[model samples]
Target: MKKSIDYSIEHKKWLNKRRNKKISVTICQFAILIIFIALWEIAGSLGWINTFITSTPSRVLASIYNLYESGVLFYHIGITLLETILGFLIATILGTFIAIILWWSETLRKILDPYIVVLNSLPKIALGPLIIIWIGAGMQSIIAICVLILIIITIISMLNNFLECDKEKILLMRSMGANKFQILFKLILPSAIPGFISVLKINVGMSWVGTIIGEYLVSSAGLGYLIVYGSQVFKLDLVMASTILLCVLASIMYLLVSLLEKIVLKHR
Candidate 1:
């Protein structure tokens, strides 16, 4: 009874230690961000850095306030956010489905392997003009660009994960009279959960990148549009403000993905 009680106490201590460590790391991250902002503000005020070019934190905030007052802040954010989310969902679902199809047919996989590699290697930017022409200069084009950028990546990552499933375990399942479909659901899919989560994480970043790039090419409204306009007009404050907003949005998306991962893993 005494040994069991002692063991429980030790386990609690270990868990507490881990919790404290996580807290400390989070605090440090916030502290570093605060310190960096302070230094940036001080440097700009002292003329140690070019405020006109870099834009101080205060100026950036003021620019954001101006956008809010004009009632356009959320409009631009919503545009970019919507595009990113749509692209992410479409690419993930389509790519995963295609991967499964490829995995199920060895002949199909072999036939498409070279083509897939070629598509993956092609520069997405070179196709941007064609995308604009094909899809037209609209939101559809933006989402299409984002999807094109992410789908190939998703296919490659997921296909590799599915292919890497344990051959021995598959054979054992076969010996037990399990069909391919049963083995896949009972083993392959379960084992690929981690890879799927990883793919989600990658998609979070790629989604943003693709959306921003699309906006750069043909958007009339979005954070990327603001960036392009700001740079053209030399409105450094707007550029800085838009950039900060992008960072915040991207970080929020990534954190949401991480939270999803935690939930899935817990259930797993």
Candidate 2:
């Protein structure tokens, strides 16, 4: 009974510490953002900065409100979000499978390593024109761009994680007569979950970038298209508003990945 009471007290103390830490971080972020906006407003109003080009936070907020009222913001946001999620899911699954295949075949991995590296090193955005031409300039092109951007990164991250698996544990499994498939499923894949989560986190931003670039190149709808349209019309406020919305969406996706990491790591 005494030990149980002590454990309860310890748990409470830990919880309190965590709560305080979170509060501190939140306050710090808000304070910095407030300071930045204040300085930006003052500078723009005082003519120290060009409001027409740079755009102030207040103008951006107003633009957001206007866009919201028109019901156009949600339409673009939804399309971009859909493209990002679809591309992320496709790239992650394919990348994980490729990593598993490479893990199992040293000869194949050796033969493909150089090709993978070359593909990864190439600038993905440069392929935008070709992708649009091949995919016919629409959601398909956007998803294709996002998938291309994410797949190589995911494969590289997962391959490294797989290679770094504990040799002793793998040897023990082998000594027990575990077959290749059993060893991969029971050991390699489980060990790489954390790395997979990390890849997802990275791909969240990349997916957004890919979709936006794709939209910029060729799309009738999406946040990127909005930005392009705003720029063509010389509406800096609209561009700023669209950019902020994109940032918010990417941040939300990143937070989801972070939550997944916590849940998966807890079981580990």
Candidate 3:
């Protein structure tokens, strides 16, 4: 009975600590946001800054409400989100496969390493025109650009992780008559989970960048298209609203990836 009471107290303490941490984070995020918005509103209202060029947060919020009322915000957001998801998924799968192949073949890895580096080093924006030409001006091009941006990063990250696997454990597996595939499944891939999550987190932002660039190059729809249109029309409020929405979406993606990492780490 005494042991049970101690365990309950310890559990309560853990819960209290977790709750406090969560509240602290929430307060910090909102505090920063509030400070920024207050400053912007003050500057604009006081005529210390050009509201026409740099709209206040209030203006942006109004634009968001206006866009929502017009029912077009969701349409643009959906297109961008779909493109991001598709491109991210394709890049992750392709990158993992390439990493696996390179891990299995030292000769192939050496031969391809330079090419991978070159591809990774190439500015993705430079490929915007080519991708639009190849995929045509639509969601396909956007997805393609996003994939191009993320694939190299994912491959490099996963390959590095795969190569960092414990050599002793690999050798032990081989001595135990484990096949190449078995070794990869049991050791290499498992060991690379943290790296994979890291890649996903990185690629989430990259995916947004690629999509926005692609949209800027050519697109009739999407948040990027909205940004371009807003800039052309000199509607700073619209631009700010689109930017804030993008931030919110990226945050959601990050939180999801973090949750995935937590689950993976728990299993580990």
Per-model TM-score versus the true fold = 0.89, 0.88, 0.89
Please give the range of 10 consecutive residues that has the lowest summed lDDT in model 2: 1-10
Off by over 4 Å in 2: 1-26
- Model 3 lDDT on a 0 to 1 scale: 0.91
Query: Model-by-model lDDT, in order?
Result: 0.95, 0.90, 0.91
| Displacement of the residue 214 alpha carbon in candidate 3, Å | 1.1
What TM-score would candidate 2 get against the native? 0.88
lDDT of 1 by residue, 1-268 (tens): 3454656777878877989999999999999999999999999999999999999999999999999999999999999999999999999999999999999999999999999999999977679889999979989999999999999999999999999999999999999999989988998889899999999999999999999999999999999999999999999999999999999999999999999899889966
lDDT of 1: 0.95
Give the clashing pairs for model 2: none
- Return the number of clashes found in candidate 2: 0
lDDT of 3 by residue, 85-173 (tens): 99989999998998899999999999998999899899877988887787687889888988998899888889999999989999999
Put down candidate 2 lDDT per residue, 134-216, tens digits, no spaces. Answer: 86978999999999999998888999999999999999999999998888999988988888888888888888988888888
Model 1 TM-score on a 0 to 1 scale: 0.89
Cα deviation in Å at residue 173, candidate 1? 2.9
